[model samples]
Target: MEPPPPPPRWFQRLDRRLRLSPLGVAWTSGREMELMHRAMGFAALGFLTLVPVLVLVAAAQPSSGHGFARWLGQAIGVTHESQLQVERLFGVPNTALQRTTAFGLAALAVFGLTFGSAVQTGYEKVWDLPTARWHTMWRHVVFLALLVGALLGFVNTPAPSGDVTGPLTVVVLDLIGTFLFFWIAQHILLGGRVRWIALLPGAVATTLGLLGLRGFSQLVFSPLIASSAVTYGPFGTVLVVQSWLVGVGFVVYGGALVGRLAHEGRVFRRLKDQDET
Candidate 1:
């Protein structure tokens, strides 16, 4: 077949303009990953599997009397009224622990492994690595254990609402904790195929994204929870929570995608220049 004709000047200019910018590069990469769809999948799998496991983790914590519901409320930055609604959803920690059984825990763990697998797969795609083998289930297990631990730490950390330093303290702690978790998580899930330096940008990006999401949740979901509960009862509240999960998924994957482009410095180069290099 004959080679395709060179692009028109206008077309070339438009392409060059987009490909040379970081935002444009992000847009392109996001489309390739079907980023929104991937985020939805992350949210769906995380909700169905990881939430149950986290509930158990919350139940197991002696310090947290309010249980998984409290964790959920804090994560989404809700106010006291909204947090109360959430506590009602899951009941108290003792109640949650009372309901737990060996068989039930095992089942939740098995399902939670799938959530870890999904996270691993997301990392692989971001790095363009081949899928890890079935034997790699051990990594998933470890990842899940660490995840539970990280969350437990978050749940247990006390940030008194009335303290002047409470908000600042939480911000600093969240930044450090989130950074370490994602940086280590990428190493673990990628099986260390990627170097720490190359993965650093992704972790930073993901952490910033999470922080931004937390801020947004505080402004939006905090009030939404109270109102939604009144309008649609528990189901409305559930919808708001699900929406937050979707945002979380979007940030986790989208941030990594942004970081990959940044690492390559492709965001600084035009498409034709990149091709030549």
Candidate 2:
């Protein structure tokens, strides 16, 4: 019986030039979510807090093939040359275990828990949920454990061959695994307040974004790694890796944002939701 109200004047003018009603909502949402800032936070916390724990877990596993470096390589899909650079950047597993002390191990675990909390906070923000109670710390512990197990399992996923089935199988398995991970992650991290169906779009979007990032890494960061290593040495390598991590952060939150937009039917309103802020 009624037409949709006209979009705000700002959107009306901008839409005329660029027809950006679709993308405009995303840009505005990114600002509202502090998306980039949260992503950078993810990169920093992931590297500083969680990585050491992962390095140890990867190295400690009796079956660890290439250790953490191998997992990192697969996670980001680096080129062969870039993979070598990453291997050199991190210490070997045995040496790490040898150098580690009980107190140090405890510290790493604590730091890992903190990293989980940071991610939980981000998820809460996405759903406009308030922070969970302190007693929920156990959820962080569980999430950290699952994350490590999942990553370790990922590195062990068999390499694909030249045959059609091999690649297809690998792709199918990856999609399933990654999807399950994010899907479960949201449920656990958000304390299960958000329904599984509500979280599905974010999980699927994140998985696709990761697949795209892997291809982009092969084309872009793979070369940048070689050059950065030559120009900036190990520090250069760190820079490239950090930049990649930022991309990961963007995708993680971006996917959830997209899911939220779809659920709320805010995909086309542009600035109309300004009051909702």
Candidate 3:
């Protein structure tokens, strides 16, 4: 019989390094980096499509006009200058705004379908599962509803006034809310196949990573936004938003990989038990 083909050089190196650390074992065993690479394209596409829809929705709410802008600025680590540029670009007469909203909403509905489908495809790939058929419309609707609700909650929360504790409090609440949102997304997108216990690690990791990204953005991307604004005008905000979404896509894929690894480990244990019996 022919000898088994030798392992890839990269895998061999990975294995050698992975053996030195338990966490590395879990991470490499799931091949999360590989999965992240595959899922990122779809995730980025979903974000690109979804962002315009969010802008439209925020524009439609006149009473909370500045609220959305402020939230967007905070989310992307941009300054008020960037937010002002956004408002100026989108500003128009009421009649024009109404027409724009109508057209934008229609376009968003179509794009939302694409976004949902892309997210489902990513989940299916990570879990090594067949495509899900049931509750397609329901799932998409629920997903959008959850997202809108989360945004509203974040924007409506009162901003910190004076106390040092206030900012920290907001951050903690935001982290918890983000964790819950990610957890629900995993459960819903995976068709409820993954258990809650197995999903927690990935959800937490993703949430913390996202929170870290938010902090990192201020130090890194803020200057980029400022320069782009000077050179490119209002469209600079769009560039920053796109870059932020790409980071989000990578985080989403990483979280899914973590959850998948935990689920597979559990399955392997059960099979080993059965074989021993």
Tens digit per residue, CA lDDT, model 2, 160-262: 8989999789788888998899999989999989988889889988899888998888888888988999999999989988989989888888888787767
Q: Give me the displacement of residue 77 in model 2, in angstroms.
A: 2.5
Report the lDDT of model 1 for residue 84. 88
lDDT (Cα atoms) of all candidates against the true structure? 0.83, 0.83, 0.70
Indicate the worst ten consecutive residues by lDDT in candidate 3. Answer: 89-98
Alpha carbon deviation, residue 260, candidate 1 (Å)? 1.4
Give the C-alpha miss distance for residue 92 in model 1, angstroms: 2.9
lDDT of 1: 0.83
Model 1 stretches with alpha carbons more than 4 Å out: 1-12, 266-277
lDDT of 1 at 66: 68
Q: Number of clashes in model 3?
A: 0
Q: Point out where model 2 deviates above 4 Å.
A: 1-12, 15-20, 266-277
Q: Write model 1 residue lDDT over 112-198, tens digit each, in one string.
A: 788889888887887788999998899998998888888877777775577788878887887899999998988898898988887
The alpha-carbon root-mean-square deviation between model 3 and the true structure, to one decimal in Å, is: 4.9
TM-score of each: 0.87, 0.85, 0.77
